[model samples]
Structure formats: C-alpha cells, structure tokens
Target: MDVFHVTDKDGNKITNEKVIDYIQQSLGTNACLLPSLRRTVGVKAASKHTAIELTGTDRPGLLSEVFAVLTDLKCNVVGAEVWTHNMRVASVVYVTDDSTGAPVDNPERLSMIKVQLCNVLKGDNDKRVAKTVVSTGVTHTERRLHQMMFADRDYERVHNGLLESRDDKFRPLVTLQNCVEKGYSVINIKSKDRSKLLFDTVCTLTDMQYVVFHGTVDSDGPDAFQEYYIRHMDGCPVNSEAERQRIIHCLEAAIERRVSEGLRLELCSGDRTGFLSDVTRIFRENGLSVTRAEVSTRADKAVGVFYVTDAAGNPVHAKTIEAVRGEIGQTILQVKESYSKSPSEETGGRFSFGNILKSTSERFLYNLGLTKSLP
Candidate 1:
C-alpha cells in the first residue's frame, strides 16, 4: 500500500481517517459510486445590490448609453463586467439605489428600468430581440456571461466575414474525436493561454450539458494545450456532424469572448454617478469602441479598465487616442501597457496619478448631485 497525505492551506497534515470520514459525510450513505453523481458544496457570497443582465447587438457608444440610463434612474453602479464578442454584447451590472445605497427593490422602478434598457439594447437595425432582466440575488457574474452568450448563439459566425479575417495566431485550434472503447468524445484544444482560459472553456462545456470525466491542461510558456474526455448528459458521445460543429464553435467562442483586444486604458478618478457615462461617451465621440470594460468603486475613488478599438473593430489611430486622452484629462485617463502581458509583468504601483483627481470637474459633478456621499 502507498501512503497519501492531506493537508489544509497551512500545511498541517489531516489524518487519512479524518479525510475518509469527511468524504463519507459529504457523500452520504446512499450516494452513487459514479463520479458524476457526486455533489460539491458551494458557498455564495451575500450581496446587497440588485444585478441587471443585458444582452444585445453590440455597437459603439452602447455601454455609455446604458450607463447614462441607469444614472438618470438614480441607480449607482457598484460593479460590472462587460464582454463583447462577434458583434454581441453581454453584461451583468450590480447596482444600488443612489439615495439608500441598497438594492433597488421597487417593482415599479425595476419595470421602468427594464423597459428603458431594453430600448437601448434594441437599436434600429437589431433583428434579434434584445433582453434585460433584473434580479436581487447573488450570482457568479462570469459564469452568467458565458450562459448569456451561449443562449444568444454568439458562437454562430457573423455574416460580415470578420471571423474569416482574424489572424491565425488569435484563432483557437479545436479538434474532436470519438473513442470507441471508452465511449467518450475526446476534445483537444490548443490556444494562447491567459488568465481564466480554463474556466471559460470548462464552463462552456458544463453549460452545454456535457460531463467532463477526465482532462489534462498543460501550459508551455504562452501556449496552452487542453484535452477533455466527455459525454453528453444522456451518456452519448457527439453523434452528428452538426452537433460536433456546434461544440467546436462554442468552445472557440468561449475562448475568444474574454480576449481583451486593442489598447488597455486605465482610468482612476473620484467616484461619481455619471463618471462612467461621461468617459465612455468621450470614447464614442472620438470613434473608439470599447471591447471590454470593468468598473469598480473603492470608497470615494472609481477605477475603470477598458479595452478599446476603432468603431470598425480595428486598432485605433495614435492621434485619436491622444486627442481622446487630452479631452478626458490626460492625468485621469492613462494608457496602460498591452493586455497581453502576464500578471507578473503587469504588477506595479497602480494609481500613479496622485491625489486621485480632486480637480474642478470632480467638484462640478459633485455640486450637480452626481457624487454619492459615503457613510
């Protein structure tokens, strides 16, 4: 017999007997022997803000318009994640009542919000219907984004021929084969690796009603290789060519959704209600379209990171960036290094623009009641 040891984060050994007992308690007496029948505990963090889920055709200035609508309705955005892929945009925004600093629970207000946001999402040329939903519950934002895009069928290649024009390096290579003896569909993926690449791929598979029985993920330098042996929920391997194609498409879409394209712009300024709206508007007016955005508020300061490109989904001209930066106050909005850098290389002192933007513009916004008073 070989010896095995288990330990907590602090490295103190957990006795083998205790580990077995814990496993038994977790599985219960009548638990099935198959790994697929096992249950894992999940702990959800409590949140005091209502979440708004939005999905629609993506366009320049769309996010700005969304934020402006929320600001007008007296909603304060505390956190948000925005992703745009293949002309489709999906986001989960967490917000609270500006006056109460609590979740927006009024049915009437929520109804009005839904109507207004739905209108914003449905532009003049959007043939597919846009959707907006408000819920007062804690959810994994990233996972929800994946589900939203999948349901919207963003994996379907756009008719504009943009997918065919992508650089070879950015495109992921995915192959699927059936293993006759094991009764499993084996998927192999090779792509440039970044943070959350595994989570994105695995999450897509799970949401597609597939079970991953075995897998291997290996990273060599910047590239990653993944292989998964999976079966459908009905215990079937991929049976048809169409199903196989869809699985490949979805996995490719999942990997591409989080790839931050274009230049990375980091903004640090005093938190205000209409701050994001104004900044995004500047980008839109300057012919820049945001591809991905992250918004967060820490105390009285607001920090935003945006990946942006030209409205045509190409690299922005240098002069355009300079002009936009000048208009938005060069100190408040600074261009960061490329998003492709590894986490270790990107680490440095943030907030180098000292004093956190206590300028006249901030005071003006505050005077107009756009600034929230933190308790």
Candidate 2:
C-alpha cells in the first residue's frame, strides 16, 4: 500500500500518526454501529457521508422493507450490508440525499425520518395485536380507536384466547454528547428494534446533512441500543444543552408515531401492458406518493408492495386508503389488452438525466401546491 505524507514548506516529514489523528478528528463522525456501543440516525460526522447500524428481529421481507422506507424518505443508498443471526437481523448502510447526494443536517427533518422508521418497526412487533387493523377490513370507528392506541401505545388487544399484549417496558430514547475536544458528538438511540430501523434512522440524519464517523449497535429481543460519534457539516460538536435536549425530544416523539399510522398496500392483478402507469396515475390523482414499490409477476398474476403516504408526506389517512384501494381495484379490472404506450415509454432504452430532472421538478412543483384542478 502506498502512503501519502503531509509536508510543510521545508518539506519536513510529518509523522503519519499525527496525520491519522487529524483525519479521525476532522473527518466525519462514525457511520457503522458495533454491538453494545452507541446509536444514531445517519452517517460520517461530515457533510456528505455518514455511518450507521440497525438491528431488530429478523423476518421475511425485511431488507426490501428497509429500502422501501429509504426510497420513501428520498435517501440514496450508496452502500449497505445485511446479516441475520439466530432470530435477529442487523444491517449497516451508508446513505445520502436522493437529490443533492449530500449528508442530511436539519434537525426537524432528521427527527421525522427516525420516527417513520420506528413506525415500520412497530408494525413488526410481535406483541402488538392490532397489527394494522385498517388493513384487516375493520369498521372505521374501530380502526380509528385501535390506531390511536397504537400511536399512543396505551391500549392492548387480546391475541388467541388470552390477553397476550403488554405495554412497552422500554421507552424510546436518543442522546448525543458533544466530544469536541475529541472532535465528535456521541449519539445514542434506544427504541423498539425492528427491521430496517437502522436505515430509517441513518437516512434521517443523512437528510438532515449530519455525518456519522464511528458507531456500534446491539439488540436484546425488542429493544435496540446504538451509539454514534458524529459531527456537523462545519465539523463542530453540538455545543448547546438545549440543542441536545431538543434532539432527544424529537427522536422520542418520532419513534412514538412511526407505525401508528400509514398503509402498506399489496396489489395482485392480471398482468397487462402499462399497468404500472395506471397505478401511478391513481396515486397522483388521489394526492398519494408511492414512497416505495416492488412489482413482480408469476404466471398470470402480478403482485406489488407499495409503501405510500399523502402528498403532505404523512401517513395516508384511513379514509384516503379506503378510497384509493377502491379506485385501484376498478382500474386494474380495466386493464387494456396491451400496455398504453406513452412518449417516455417509446423513448426508453437508456437512462436520461433530463427525465430524472423532470420528475424531480414535478415533485417540487407539487410540493409547492400543484393540483390536478389547477390550470
């Protein structure tokens, strides 16, 4: 391996040890998590990178779900590792912004990201009896009551012939200690461990533009522990006690609401041309954003997993989910003998940066209040 040495004007040889220390001190904070160590949301304590870890009970469809959340949050996955041992799953991922490809730095934004992830984990909790009552075709009022309980974690339903649910013994927690003299912020996170929890937290931080330098993570059943040494974009440790408190508060609240709402829709239809386009049209017309999607075909059947939210980026309300499903059922039935070809469809063959820009621009416009009813 070749080594590059730092030099002064006189070309004095600088000890490599001093340079390595500066690199660790000045480079972004940790991005990966080690068991029994700290916890965090996103990567390197630097501006454009971060290191992170997530651990939870392992299950089928876990990896895909994590990516789905990342796609929904608009975080770009640059590198990742997925491993499962015994009944637990651990993932280490490096993420960046979808648009700017930079670290996420805004606090309010990062909090929301972690919260969404926690909700995903909530959906995976074995003790939760409701388990998305809205998806089970229950009464509107009943669903409402149950969802509230989920969000508040105050109600429990019976499983089997006995009451099998219990309150969360471990409340969610997130903390960051500024180690500026050492040049990093130590971030710790404790929440319900679930699949993709790591990605969601890390992606959130990436969106906020913070970086991770060093991190460690471990899980015991449903509770997860993580630690991260981080830095801000300007390479400074968090200096305010108020700021630290705010960080803790936001993560606590975010974890509470993570899976208390939102709908995960699965659709299976007879395959035909242009089906995806029609589905997306339904999403746009109904003010839905397809946060994540997986589509596949087996024999004559087409199956898809859709992680969705309203245009405002909150979970799709119960009323809206119902209405959208009804519309989707009708649209799939109206599938054409062949896919409806469009201008872009015909132009397919290679990736186009222009098309990417156009799509992003459309979302930006919509976020600024675009409407189908608009002229």
Candidate 3:
C-alpha cells in the first residue's frame, strides 16, 4: 500500500519523464502539486440558511408550537431534523427569510426567535432548563444533534411515574472491555440494523474524546455487530468502572436518538407558510406525539416524514388514526408504515410510497426519483 507509481487515467504506467515535463509545461507555472492531498470527497456546500439548535423536555404539540412561532416571525423553514429520546427532544432547524430566501441575520429578529422558542421549549412543568441558540457555523446536522443531546445529558434515565420500559429486543447491547496488552479499550455493540447506526456510535466516541485506532462492523439481516478499539486522547484506556458505564450509556443514547419509534406518516402537499405547523397541530389534536421527523422542501412541494405515537408514548389506537386521516385528508397524508409495539394496534399495511401516490403527477414522481421521465 506504501508503494508509489505514476500512472495515467487508464492505469498505464508513465515511464517517460519527458511526457510529465510536457504535461507540466502545458499547464501554467502557478500550478504546483502538494506531497499529499487532504480528502474531502463527501463534503457538502455551505447552506445559505440560518441554523437554530434547540433542546428541551419532550412533549406533545411542542413541535407544532415551535413551527407556529417561526411562521409568525416570517422565517421559512427549509429543512429540519428532529429526534426524541428518553422524554427529551433535540432538533436542528434551517430557516431563511420568507421573501428573500436569505439567512435571517438581523440581531433583533434572531433574539426574538430565540426568546419565543425558548419559551415554547420551557413548558410550564419542565424542571430542566430549556436552551435555544442560533448557530452561524457549519456542522454536520446529525453529529451536531448528538453533541447537543449529549450536552443536555439525555442519556440519563427518566422515571416520571410512568410505566415506561424499552423492549429488550430494541435495547442495544453495549459492553466495554480493556485490552491491557494492546493498551486500548474495546467497545462492542450489538443492535438491530438501521441507517446511521455506525455513524451514531462513532460520533459519540469522537465527541467523548476517544480515538478509534481500529474497528470492525458486520451485519446479518437485521442485526448489526460493531467492535472498536479506542483510547483516550491522553493515550489511556478506559480507566474506571464509572467511565466504562458512562461510555456504554452514551453510546446507547446516541443509537436510540434516531430510532423511529411509532407509526410512520408521510405528508406530501403544496408548500405553504405554516404548513408544518398546521399538520403537526392536527397530530397533537389527535393525541399523537412526534418521536422523529424529517422535513424538506423540493420545488413547490413540501415533503415530511414523521414518526408519532400516543401522547403517553403508547401505540395509538386504530380509531384515532382513522380520525386523523379523515381530518387531515387521507390523500395528502398517508401512513407509510407502522412500528407499534403491539401488533393488534397496527393500523397500516406495509406498502411502497410510490404505489400510494400513484395519482400524483409524473413530474412530481420524476423529481423524487420514483419514476423515470420519458423522452
């Protein structure tokens, strides 16, 4: 792997220095090659919108209220990612001016936005302080969510006098073992396979100031297994039992934050101001609480995917779902899947979203890559 050889695009070795010299001469003299090039293969362009970070106690209708406040402030939400875990919610929302489509940079307006959002986050009975901040820096959305939740200490278990229990199968198996000979702490995780599973655990370790020297990941059907050899930044392995447990809990929280824990709902409709606010209001009215949400706009259409359960985090009844569908228009908002813990409470069948939206225009389907446009 350390061997070096100069080759053309076709993989043919270039043995002639004259050819290299000619190529260099053809280019300008200002062009110079560095000894090594840092890789940035998957970096995305900077967003032209303002990013707001929010974390607080989770509750029904909280997201709706937040969106309503943003709409009232004339801030248009272009995108957002929301996650809820252990009765704590954290979200990163990207917004722009409704008219200019530019980041809302006015200091006064931003302060008002923060104040209103902070009020909504700090509901009447929240014991922990809610937080709201406007961020000007660029950060990976998902990674930032992990950092925020970690800082908010979402890993701590909450006992709010409710019979809340996570299913054994859904709980991630996290164990830490120290390798004395190798001078590394090994972390092994076994959990159900899903998108970003590795990313969540690695981000947690990285944020905790651990360096992963080596790692291996394997998945079999729905289950995934990961092992990482890591050490502290100070070149030490996990030094104490408390630290080991802390790492384990943090990793579990990271993985669980993104878990969609309820019935999946997909909303496709024409973009409009307060669209999310109205829809989430309907959900709240129907006694549903959003566990996870991904909102985006493409062209003139708004696309949102939400996972929601009963306000108390129990499976929603079939009648409640029917009532919501009837009120929200079944065609515009469809149930894509169900993740209810109780099979008897499941109301929707597993079907492809494209099949459900067959009546939509071909252009819309083409834009979503659900169909190919004919020449």
* Top-TM-score candidate index: 1
For all predicted structures, in order, the TM-scores are 0.78, 0.32, 0.77
| Alpha carbon lDDT of each predicted model | 0.73, 0.46, 0.72
Predicted candidate 3 versus true structure: per-residue lDDT over 1-375, tens digit per residue: 011122332224555677667655735566543211111111112358787778888899999898989999998888788888888888878788898988788888878888888888888988776544443434666777888788888888855766447877778999999988668898989887655566678778988889987665655556777767799999999999999999999999888887778888877889877778888889998899998888888889988788889988888898998898898788888886665221211222211111111223334434544334722
Model 2 lDDT, full chain set: 0.46
TM-score of 2: 0.32
- Please give, for residues 85-198, the per-residue lDDT of candidate 2 as tens digits: 223334444466667767655566556556665565445464432121101111121112222222332222223355533235434668777764477777888776543345
lDDT tens digits, residue span 215-270, model 1: 65655556777777799999989998999999999999998888877889888889
The order by descending TM-score is 1, 3, 2
lDDT of 1: 0.73
Deviation in Å, model 3, residue 17 alpha carbon: 33
Off by over 4 Å in 2: 1-172, 179-183, 206-209, 233-235, 241-263, 273-302, 307-375
Best to worst by lDDT, what's the order?
1, 3, 2
